[model samples]
Target chain A: MAREKFQTLTEQMFYILLALQEERCGADVMALVAQITQNRVAIGPGTLYNLLEDFLAAGMIVQTKTEGRRRSYTLTQQGRDRLLMEKQRLERMLSDYRHMTAGTEKNQRDTAG
Target chain B: MKRKFEFNLYAPFQYQDLQDHLEKMAGRGWELEKAGYRLFTYRAAPPATVRYAMAFRPEVGWMDQLPTQGQEIYADYCRDAGWELAATWSRFPQVQFYRSRKQYPVPLETDLTSRWRVTAQWMETRFVDPLRGDVAIGCFFAIFLAIVLTIFLAQEEFAPPLFAMCAAADVLMILLVLNQLVVLVDAQRWLQQAKRAAEEGSPGPGGRMSLPWKLTTGLLIAAGAATLAVYVTNATADFGFLAPVRIAGAVLVFYITLFAAFRFRDLLRKRGGSPHWKWIVFTLVATLLALLSVELWDWFTDF
Candidate 1:
């Protein structure tokens, strides 16, 4: 099967989608992404706001609630599916790399002996 | 002692320049107090280090209720991210200012894509939409110019100097509009490149209007104003005080019609949720009313 566009997510997109798995406000999403990524991926306010707008527009996320000025959003079914697809794609690449490296290590050990 | 205020003008597209200027002002103990179209007002304050970041949001408007839902949410997000709302300019692009005192400035938009998207959206709504509107305005101007030319040509004793001056001014006005259209096209091209750069994860080149374009626009406006002044002076000289009075009335009517149309459009946007139709209707009605008022005044005064 041909992979769909955006089946592979950027590091920022992955963390953002991962954070949105549960309902959260934009500010909360920033915090969660920073925490989950251990400060390695920092999504600024502007990026979070625009990405959320894009996600909502693309039907990847839905606004769940609006409490005063803060709007809460969660991943839509499509978003979850995309996230899972990316996870599987990443897993396959890791598995291939592991297999290749394992064979090379074993061959090296045989040659050394 | 009262605090002193200073006015500074910056080009709208020079967002980086605006930020740097504001920072420089802050360091000079002149903190930004307000922002208007092409103008910034600063008040004297204790010297402090403040970093300014600008974000463009087109959904916000001057007439709309302050702290709108989207605006509030965005402000809160920025506040949480260490930025404090400093000022807002309710113009096209609808710039919002954020200031931070941190040692390292934290940008509101970290990714190039988001930054480009905001700017591109601003350009589309403000420039592109207006460019579409300009077509109708251009047609109307063409008809008006044709009528003026016909009236002058039909004169039994056409004075070449007067006709030539009037024709020159009309041409300049048309050229002004065309120059604006060119600027809009250039702006659209810049935005497209910016979007492409964003997609490639690089900061796009900032948009800037050409110096020649700016100078031409300035020249055209000055010429138009000078021509208008000359016409008014000649009319007053020939027709006594009545001419000035009539001219003032006409100018008043023009402004009043403009105010009413904008108010009507804003009112429709607030309630019925469709302002585009409001704009179209108001424009047509305003033009009719303006023409009718001028004709009726002329007839009543036996001019």
Candidate 2:
């Protein structure tokens, strides 16, 4: 079955929403994402612009202010809920990994002893 | 400034090729100044390395000369990122060319999936839809021609020369239809492959002037030439030595009228006064000029 659009966010989409958690302009959001990720994930200007447009259309983000071409955006409650849901999904996956790996390590130790 | 003009034949989807070609020209001390329908103008400049990016704005009409407010804002965003709007060409999916001013500027697009999505939308709007219309129109004409040929064949006095001319024109139309079909299929295939790569979190496919494309274009040109030859030969029987002259005059009238309309539009744009109604004005002017040219040609030929 096909999933709904934005139902499962891509890594870039996730980070863009996280960046908009606080009101930030487009370029600032881009710089903040790179800084937070320690220069690991770099968002291109075109990509950021497109994602912001989509977020605004999807009602996940709201435009807080506009100065000339510079516009600032912040995540709405819907956006925060979406981001939290994705975080929980990732946490569950991590917990499952830990549970499986811990049992495997314990069994190996038992066999060795 | 010294300038030169050349016809660009790359398809709209072949943005990579256009970008590389412009960069190569810039390295040779020529920089792009403007782009119009099938033509690029370059001015002499010092040799430099420049990165080019193509951004598509599908909302822009094919005849739109003045940029919209949204387009200006988009350019503003790109400008802040070290890219400057170099030229704009109003193809079906209107495109703007941006050149990087700084050394090793950051890429305009980074997300593979987002890039693919934008490109796919442009392709669907400009390439697939238009080609489908062309193919359908071609099929309708082919069927009409077939019916005409059948009726001619049933005549009591079958004329070999007329039949031969019809056959030549038929071959030309068939080649045109076949070329359109090939392009449609190729575009769909490219989109499918790009989609798969994007799904895998990789960059979409890059476009090139493939061999098949070249061969198809060559074949269409040859077919057109052959059809024209048959036409000239048939007309010579009725019009004496003036057949080829008449044909050339008609072609001249068509090209001159088209060029005049576009040049006028460009002049308005340069003066920064092109309004939305310019399209209608251009069309009316072109039609009048074409009619005048045709009438003058007939009078000159008769004289």
Candidate 3:
């Protein structure tokens, strides 16, 4: 599961999506993501708002409500599809690669010899 | 200490929107140092800033001109509760003088028809982009997105290609415009600066923008005409030829919009048509007739 997740995730992109998947608001998403990241990434309001603003403009996310002078966001059908596609690609690669390498170094040497 | 700007109102304003004007004041190197009720101080920046200040605000009038008694009262009321009035004079009402006389700012170009002749001229001339760097950057980004869209019609990778590109472009443009707008809020700052500059007088302020700007405008107009002539003669439409067309268009549009808006709004407030309009119209008609005759001759002679 970890390998599959790691294979598909873009560090910033994944965290943003993960944050939004739960909170359902823009400010909340930013806040939750900041906490989870331990403040390593301090995105300014413009940058964060810009990204979410872009997402909403593109219809990748829908704004649910206003939270204390901030808006909330959740993934739309398109965004969900995109996230799932990335996950499936990673999952497929993991299962297939493991099967092919199942014999390991010992099996390869004996079989070749 | 560096030279600073100061605003002096010979007459008072009623709904004086200083921030909006000042934000429009700075260009290139000049920036706001301090702003108050009716005085704005710009810290003399590098030479470029001064030049930019000269170029940008040159003489952008407030609401096109000074306010009348009725409008003045209305604007004063519009002022924040704590704001104070600076100086007022009724004799030279609507007459604002730059503290320092750097040659008068070049009047902006005033043509906006998207004609091929104009585009050719724009390409021929060197145009200093009126927009600031950040604004230019945002514009470039929009162009970049367009380029990307041209290459990638649509695939989920960039998904809804046109829509996504357009969305990003629009949002970025808004952000860019807003960023500039916030700075524009310095009207009070600029007015203060301009007023102070007026009071202190221009540093080496003997220079004037009018002469140079006028010549440049004339040159641009001539270049546009020449370009149009050349294109008509050559009968080809290419990048090399069309570059000047854009500048010419920009200059023409910028000046026309600035002056028209200024004059029209001012007329409405002053309740008197600007005397300058008569001269301008006369000059414009004469020039047009000359051009038309020349064109008619060329058609007959094919030169």
Candidate 4:
């Protein structure tokens, strides 16, 4: 939802990039999405794999090395910085929401009194 | 082996319409390979069901072998089927479903991607021969027109030497037209080879206007000009030192203009300029300018 800039990168780009940041391989990335979204969201090899291709193109994550038909992607400085920035913005939003909701709760208690 | 025929249909025809037509003739058995971009390469058709194909050309390329010649059969058929015949290259009027032993169907690929464009690079070439010859003819025509117009405006002033100049221009025109036709025939043959070459993935027209062709045409013009010069010199007043040199310089310039045009043709081709049309226009403008320059020189020197 916070991705206001990456219009062409699409919905799957963020999820795939986030998965890569966790030191996950392709299969692991697919499994992680299933576990995190409780299998409600599914990404196909053809489509999801293409997003991973975008990361490869964007130079965010590169195939650090290959091991037995398995290629691993590692974050470049750009990717890590981008992910950390997203996390910080999300955390700030969460804190703002928490304080606002607590004030709303206190106001409700006073009205009941 | 009764040489098997294959149909390579490349077009961007209406899909639903094509699908319905293909479905109607589904029972007609032929090993089919339905590649994307509305391409369906067909093998020999069975005797039972008639072979049918319908597809549209992608923006990049097109092929239709089955053009019904002036009989209006194919046009009528396409009209009925809601198919509009795509524009074919005017130079090759024989566009439509051409019969080929399935092995020999015409290939359709992007012209820009072809090897003719990719591989044809000129390095340190001083003159464009085959190409310049064409341009020279174009310049000759323009100069002829200028000469004719200058004479006409001067109002029937056919001086003793004017007749020779006019005759020379006439001879040059005849030679140019004849040579253009001869080269045009070769161009047609080369175009046929190009169609085949592109099919083979060469991605080029696969030929060049040769040295002999270029040399002969240039010589033909030079010979005609030299003969004219001889006659003009004999008829005109006895010349000073500059007259012979001027005549020599004129011949040299004419030949070299053509050479430069041909040598640079490949470079010009890379830049997407038409050698045929560009040379023609160049010839026209250069000849006009040359004639004008001569007139200017005459005026200045007289003053």
Candidate 5:
């Protein structure tokens, strides 16, 4: 099977898409992402703005409402599917690492015994 | 006591240098009050530490009162992230935002690809578009000059010295235009290099105008002005009434062309339509104005 176009997501993109799971304004997304990442991953305004525009253009997100100067957006179904796929890919990597390490440790214990 | 002000020039592609320079100025108690094309004004203030970041937005025009929707949204996010919009220069398509170093500073652009896109857009709008326009104008002027020179040379009673002076001035004007084109091309090259570096997540080299090119351009302008003065004085003595009328007509055309250019730009920006039709309308209006001005001058002189 051919590889997916967006099979791998950058850390910033992943967090941004995750933050958009709930309908939030641009500022709200920044604050929520900061909170969720425990201040470890900080998305800059320029990066977030461009990413949102790209996402909106790609149909990954849809703007829900605009009040005054602020705009709020929510993830579309495609966006949610992409996020889920990325999460599953990350989980598979983690499990593979665990299995490899466990096998190496067990071999060491058998040799010692 | 009034604060002191200083003017400094920065190229559009010198974002890092401008940022560092602004930060250094803040350390020495100077704050940026306004920014313009090649000119930055700073006001004296108490010494403090501040970090500056520049973001490029090409969609915002110079005369726009309210920020565009995208700009407003971006500003809101930046403000919440602790960056304040300090100054915006439409000529350069950049917004300078700042925050105190004491506060946790958030990077304005975390990703390299987005940074490259911003810079690329600025280059295209500010440098590439203007260069294309300038080149077209330069070519038209060159052809007009050639035709006029040829006709002057063919005339039996032409003043050789005056004609030579006028020709020299015209040549200088062409040189100045060409020099400008060269500088713009250099700037575009620097921007392309910067974009490539951004793709690789590295800082690119700063853009600067060549010293020799600047000096030559200045010299050509001065020489052109001097020759024009000499030519006008000689022509007035020789052709009397006709010289003044011609000179007035030329001046009127020049000013009206400039006014038309600005009006067309504003119209296109505000209306957001096909530029081809807009340009044709602009040219037609400008030509009519020139003809009307020449007729008015003839009538006023007759009276």
Candidate 6:
């Protein structure tokens, strides 16, 4: 099934928004994503270019400044809200993991005891 | 500087092979100068290792010329990332060719989903739909030819020359159908593989030089040669030795007119001319030229 546009953020999209929490250029966003993820997540230049365009169109990111071809952007309120929503969704998943595994461990301990 | 021309029929989905081929040429001291319909021109340059990247801008349409305002901005983005605009196919300006000497950790398009979506669009627009249309037309032609041949046989009016000509046409149509089918299958397979890769967040299954595409091109050439051979061989006394010559002349005239039309469009685009009315002008001029040529040929033959 086709996904609704930007309903849920991919890892790259989430990190891109996280990077734009501070006013950063497109290249800076790419660099920051890789750095903050310890090289685990890297955004290609073409992908970064496209995501920035999409973000601008969606009103999730506002262009802070333009230096010739290089443009800087920071997250809008909507973008920030979306980022927070994604974080909460991920935390919920982690909590579910802990709860489910906690029951399994408790059962094993009870049986052993 | 020395120059070389080569036939390049690789579809947009096979961009990996296209990029690698260009890079290899660059390593051999040749740089791509132009890309046209199934043709690439390379110019001798200093030997260097270059990485070629392909990207598509969906907004760019068929009629738009190179480096439209939007495309210029897109190129600027690539420039900032160390990629230089190398060349673009005049017919499809959406497919941008970028080259860089600076090494990057990843390819131009890193996101598998984005790459898949772009490539899928190209595959649909550029290859699959077009080939499907071609195959459908070929089928219709084959059916029409079969009906005509059956009627001729039933009426006992089929001449040896006509039969041979029909046979030649059937062979050509069959070859065309096969060629289109081969490419269509290859495109569908690649699209499926790409979709799976995108889902897995893995590197795309980049297409290589497909043997099927090479065979398709070869079959097309063979079909043309066979058709010409049939025309030459079946030049009977009633058909006249000049029949083949007349057909060749007509073919040449039409081919020249079509070539002129494309060249005019390309020239107009290069001059920043509007594409809105170019098609209208091209059709009128090409039809007039073709009709005039046919009339002239008739008058000359009578004279």
Best-fitting candidate, scored by lDDT: 2
Which candidate tops DockQ? 2
Off by over 4 Å in 4: A1-11, A67-70, A105-113, B1-33, B36-303
Residue-level lDDT of model 3, residues B1-303, one tens digit each, is: 565666633112211233224334444334455433334556655433121111111122332344443334322221211122332222223222222113332111111111112222221121112224544676577567656654554443443433444444444444444444433232223344333333333321122222333444445455445545554333323344454554455445544544454344334434445647644654565566556555544443332
lDDT per residue (tens digit) for residues B1-303 in model 4: 122233322111122243334433334544333322223444444533323332211111112222222213333323323333333221112222211123322122112223221122110011123445665678577567756756664676676565556656655655665565555455545445544443443444423445545665876669586666755475345556556556555556654554454334323323443346756665665676567656644543331
Pairs of residues at least 3 apart in sequence or in different chains that clash in candidate 6: none
- Weakest 10 consecutive residues of candidate 4 chain B by summed lDDT: B118-127
DockQ each candidate and list the results: 0.41, 0.47, 0.01, 0.01, 0.43, 0.39
User: Residue B283 of candidate 4: its Cα lDDT?
Assistant: 66
Model 2 C-alpha lDDT per residue in residues B1-303, reported as the tens digit of each score: 899898887877777888899999989988889887778899999999988888866555545546765577677778767889888874442677889857788788878777777677667776678778888888788767856766665673457767777776767666776677777777888877666655655777777766777788789889889878887787788678887787788778767777777777665554444456666776788788878877866764452
Candidate 2 off by > 4 Å: A102-113, B61-65, B101-104, B142-170, B192-202, B226-250, B263-303
Clashes of 4: 27
Lowest summed lDDT across 10 adjacent residues in model 5 chain B is found at B90-99
Q: On residues B1-303, what C-alpha lDDT tens digit does candidate 5 reach at each position?
A: 335444454555666666888898899988877664445667777888888888777666544433556777788888878888777653443454455464458888887666676777777776677777887787678767856766675673456776677667666766766666666766767777766755554655464456755676777777777777776677677768588667766667666655565555444445644556666776787677777766765663441
- Each model's lDDT comes to 0.71, 0.77, 0.41, 0.46, 0.72, 0.76
RMSD of each: 6.1, 4.4, 24.8, 21.3, 6.7, 4.9
Per-residue lDDT of A24-82 in model 3, one digit per residue for the tens? 65445545766888976443322343345445766767878754444567888877776
* Tens-digit per-residue lDDT, B1-303, candidate 1: 335444443445567777887898889887777664445667788889989888777666534545566777788888998988887663432677888888675578877766776777776776567766785587578667856766676673456656655765666656666666666666667767766765665688664556756776777777777777766776776678788777777777665655565555444434543346655665787677778767755653443
Rank the models by lDDT, top first. Answer: 2, 6, 5, 1, 4, 3
Q: Which candidate's TM-score is highest? A: 2
Clashes of 3: 52
Model 2 residue B220 distance off true place after TM-score fit, in angstroms: 1.5
Which digits, one per residue and each the tens of the lDDT, describe model 6 over residues B32-89?
A: 9888766788999999988998887766656666567667766765776688888887
lDDT of 6 at B53: 84
> Candidate 1 at B186: error in angstroms?
1.3
Model 1 error, position B173 (Å)? 2.0
